[model samples]
Target: MRQYKKVLLGVASIVLIIVLAACGNIDDSSSSTSSSGKKTTSVQTTGQVSKSEYAGVIKNGHYLTSKARGLTANRNSNSLNITSFENGLLGVSKSYYSTSNYIFQEGQYLTTAKLTNWLGRKSKSNPTGLNPKDNGKKNSSRNPIYVESIEEQDFMQKNGNSLVLKGITIGIAMNTIDYYQKIKYGATYQQTITSKERVAYGKKVAKLIVERMRKIKKIGKNVPITIAMYKQAANDSLVGGSFYAKTQTTSSNISNWEKMNVENKVFPEISSTSDYASNDNKSFENFQSQIENYFPTISDVTAQAKYVNKKITGEQVTITTQFYSETEIISFTNFIAQVAPKFLPSGVPVNITVNSANGIQAFLSRSSTQRNFKSHVFSSY
Candidate 1:
């Protein structure tokens, strides 16, 4: 399996560290009632860091997966967009559901079979498909699958003995480019989807999904659902796609639409375009340059920098090295730890992974809430 270098999960997540100079720390917990109306022992307490826990589940440490897991696994083709689509949805969900108040569960309502029908071309038999009906011709305008796939996330709140649904977030991943083969083992043709066309189709699917979901038995009819439109990158794109806009259900339909500016861009590539501010592009260039100049033996040096509202949020630097010795990896990672903070985005979580032919050789990361970066070197000796 190809390991996508761009993924630096939890970089933008909040790492709340309450020092409690005066009062004690406040812990995020949930209370639950027994099925027979009896009270169970409260597992939550307020104080310094004791152990990792979540609010709503019967278990303390592990999160519960949806009863239907991996049903929509075949929806996405690109490896980069899959990770981004999943993690990015949670980030977008933060606006609607606070982590302290809600626990997350995999999408519970939508089944793989349901999603398969929705992603297929709309037909007389499969009326729920979001794509336009397949005409005989391969015209770019009529042939493409406007809606690539659908992703759902369910946020739950502790109501009684069980965790009830608080809200739902659905991501409509639209294809920027669609590939098709007219005949079996024939020439493959490609079509490019314009931004306007993608948005129109994506919004159409969103409306249809909301309307269809309202009829479902499990999902609440008027549940507060946050739907986001993501323009997926090309199949071969190294960086993942971005969430450009989001909206919530005001009534039965989507309303209060808002544009989002979340992006994951190649650090050096931004210099050629006016995507991000000049300051960040230059910082990454300088950081990349220093490593190249000093460590000529390094196989490759690349960084995927995330920008939200035009400010750098997090950047992942992958340094591919030919050296396999533990001592050499330790030296290279030590240098990276010292200079990364100075050149990369300040105070934001930055992950640096050093890779060799054997696998991950070393790793370094600094959380957004901290000043110093933590480093680890794998022992290959």
Candidate 2:
């Protein structure tokens, strides 16, 4: 972990001056730029998803937005799952829609309202409902809204200036717990969903979804499709859950579902669990302890690390603070900037968010290519 923390002092000043260095939901840019100052995500050529242009540049400086936007907020009751469901879908899509072959684009086939109806419970009013009907039954086993939300990602290949849709990826956000109210506006009771049942239901929904996309959406039969299942984390859970399994289709029909041993666990979680990456947890604990020791005013420090095949891949840490002064924020950020790479696991991108009760104070990220962190201090005004 410590070996990857070698500090590069050459570009420290230049990095700190940049406003926003990467693309994300919370950030300004939709394109990702590397340390070399060139946009690492772009599709300058036509035909096949270009590796250099994975994000797929639509215009000179603009990026294309999916037909469906902002509907994600209504997808899950838990905010954490919403973020996980969206980001994790793309993460899983990279495997099937390789950037080397296809450029990235938002799902264009599904509409916000259509998705809303699909996620809705099966009923006379909404025939597209993917969730099982409640049938006024008080029992969860008999009926529950097991399917939470749906997401789509389109993979494109360039032909001259125009782009060709080569594939469509769908993400099924499934619930681990079925929260039901026996009566309207009554007490809510949760029915725990087992892993076996969760995966089985997810596959059924995926196949059915593809069938509809072809019949109704007019999707070309030759366009490849990928389907991934993401397990939604409990609303109260600190970290959002991750995609567990994915299946790819050559034509229109999905086949040979492959199991993905992916998971997301918050730091300071149960260390006794078999999945616990012992060394990684220890490093996070040390990082938390150090922050606590240095800044007593900081409220808390927590990390959500993603594991693939039992190995740590990426981590996002949040530090809640009581400080407001820019000097104090920079000072604390500098301290974190110095100790983070030294104490935390490396070779994976790590993003740290410093937050105040009001909102986000600053954001710092270390990409896999860089030895140091690129940061932005939000304006206090």
Candidate 3:
């Protein structure tokens, strides 16, 4: 019996050792996580803290409230309200308390002076062509006109019944001398000023913003920045309209900045009856299908279509058809002029061009003026 007791004691010692080892491992993991400045429980329970929780923490915080006030003053909107805040997170709403109005506002946490300096750099980079003193020459001013106002705001997008933070929009109002000239002289209509020029100027300003933001350590590495350039008119209001460009910092720090353009001037919602509001791609696809079924002999031809929305001349569709032989060109053009129009969106003008296998080209438009075969086609043959 004594021998059996000695064996049992040895087994109990081994079991105790295993239990202590497991407990030690758990403690070590917890300590490591805490040491790295992460709450193990919080991290394990939820990868992200809820916006509501953050709101509760900073609901009555004085510093954040002051910041919120400053944001409102800059945006020229009294609707901005800070509803929530956390260490590196902020939530704001405009007029409503719902998520749709709520914008998630967070960045590298820049000082007022730093933000001012960043805007100053952008001002210096403005293209000389847009400067009044240069008269559209390539003489960029050493002290280029800076943005009149700068504001950062989070805009929300509606998702079903709820609203989600879309992204941060940096609004900068620029009162360039050329912009004032355009407004006073209606140069925008005179073709002296163009949307392309404004878009190019907007891109330069956006590049500066992206460059400065990337240097900040606290800003989210993948967070996108949209720079909106608002042209201030003679009335002192930013009414000349705005152009914007969006950019994001990649892991390699190379920014693939998209071409800047005027904000979506195509108001589909307001003009539901307009053909420009219709899906051009879908219409083009249906037209191609009809052509294949109606004329099997020409079915092998490739057809491509594009829709363009011009502010002044309205909506236009361009269709290009490639024929297998010169003989098919005439038949194809006729089909495009008669049958293709039926599949197109109503009220939209279309220009159809037929390219023959022999390199001959003929174009026909809704108006008779544009209907012509190129003179080079006969000369080439």
Candidate 4:
């Protein structure tokens, strides 16, 4: 492992205690079935709390395109906490909040649900090619996958024994594309990855994840981050590895490798000036351009850990500090609320509120990319 420089990107808004005065009451009554078998509810009470108190963690969370690829996380943390499974079978929807009593899980989080709806619903010009006709009735059954594992990594720069710094890494492994293909195409499917398609989808997922998480922290700032996709070895030159260079050595090595391959990879495909001038240089440049044309760029965080010591030893223990800005927390929360509704108790109502200052501006900001993403609960009004 190599050391990377740590930078302070930006400070989150200070918590200013403001008075939010609101109150609600609830009453409940229970009844049992007299005739056959099923017991039903008589009366139920639901309450609302201040936004400041809206907090909880939903575990075993999953999204269904076919089966589930568990993408679980602490709703309050930026590090996407995930579990590892061999076939990418993990949870999709589990609800957790710090302030459980205050935050009502009965109704859906308005902004979160919309974002999720956008994720599953197909669009007329979806870059991923997933559409309504594509995800149809052949694959009818659906269930939220349960999570099995969880791991955290320390990614922090320490100064002294006083513990002046801290950071964390959370990862979730999933088989999302499996479900996507099964439901959309009526059979389990795997992504066909050409180098171009891989690069394009990789970039696409990276961009989306960044944009998705950026709501918490403006991306490319001080947040030292990395993401990678995990799949069986394809070409086998390298297994699913770090997306970008983590250490100086790795970065340099990757640069050298690219330089070595450039001549054979870039210029040999070009045509001569005579052919260019005579035949108009008909090339596959456009076909070869695998830009952000895929969905959910499969990725894992490439967290860099730093140290204050110049020496190394087996006894040496490194500590890192990681915290989520309120924005990032809300962004992740909204993401779960939007995408994980299918796993909630059956008949659970979901309402998404966005397009306002306090609503879900994070995802909706990408309006051009999310045209079909509409509000079914809140916007219904």
Q: Which candidate number would show the highest TM-score if scored against the true structure?
A: 1
| Number of backbone clashes in candidate 3 | 2
Residue 73 deviation, candidate 2, in Å? Answer: 11
Screening candidate 3 with a backbone cut-off below 3 angstroms (N, C-alpha, C), the clashing residue pairs are 55-84, 100-163
Best-first order by TM-score: 1, 2, 3, 4
lDDT of 4 by residue, 225-297 (tens): 2333332222211112111111111110111111001000111133445432122112222211211111133
**TM-score computed on alpha carbons, candidate 1:** 0.81
Better of 1 and 4 by TM-score: 1
lDDT of each: 0.71, 0.72, 0.36, 0.24
lDDT of 1 by residue, 1-381 (tens): 111121232122222343322333433244456899975533222332322222333223233344333222223367788778877887888788877777666676886567767777778988877788887676665568777657788877765445677788988888888866667565766789999988888887889989888887677687788898888888778788999999998456876579998878776773366645567778888888887655667767788888899888988888887765666677777888888888888768899888878788889999888777799998833
Candidate that would win on lDDT: 2
Regions of model 1 farther than 4 Å from truth: 1-63, 67-76
Report per-prediction Cα RMSD to one decimal.
7.4, 11.2, 25.4, 27.0
Look at candidate 1 and give me any clashing residue pairs. Answer: none
**Model 4, poorest ten-residue lDDT window?**
256-265
Which digits, one per residue and each the tens of the lDDT, describe model 2 over residues 1-381?
001111121121111122222333212233457799986533332223334345553433334556554343222267777777777787778877677877777666887667767777777877888887657667755566778767788887766545678888888888888776677566777878998988888888888888888775446776777888888888789988888888887665776888889888788666546445777888888989988777668778889988898888899999898866888788888888899988777899899999998899889999877789888889845
RMSD of 2: 11.2
With a 3 Å backbone cut-off (N, CA, C), the pairs that clash in candidate 2 are 42-53, 43-53, 46-158, 47-158, 47-159, 49-101, 49-102, 49-103
- What is the lDDT for 141 in model 2? 56
Residue range 251-297, candidate 3, lDDT tens digits: 32435654333321221123345444346545555666666554445
| Per-candidate count of clashing residue pairs (backbone under 3 Å) | 0, 8, 2, 45
Q: TM-score of every model?
A: 0.81, 0.78, 0.32, 0.24
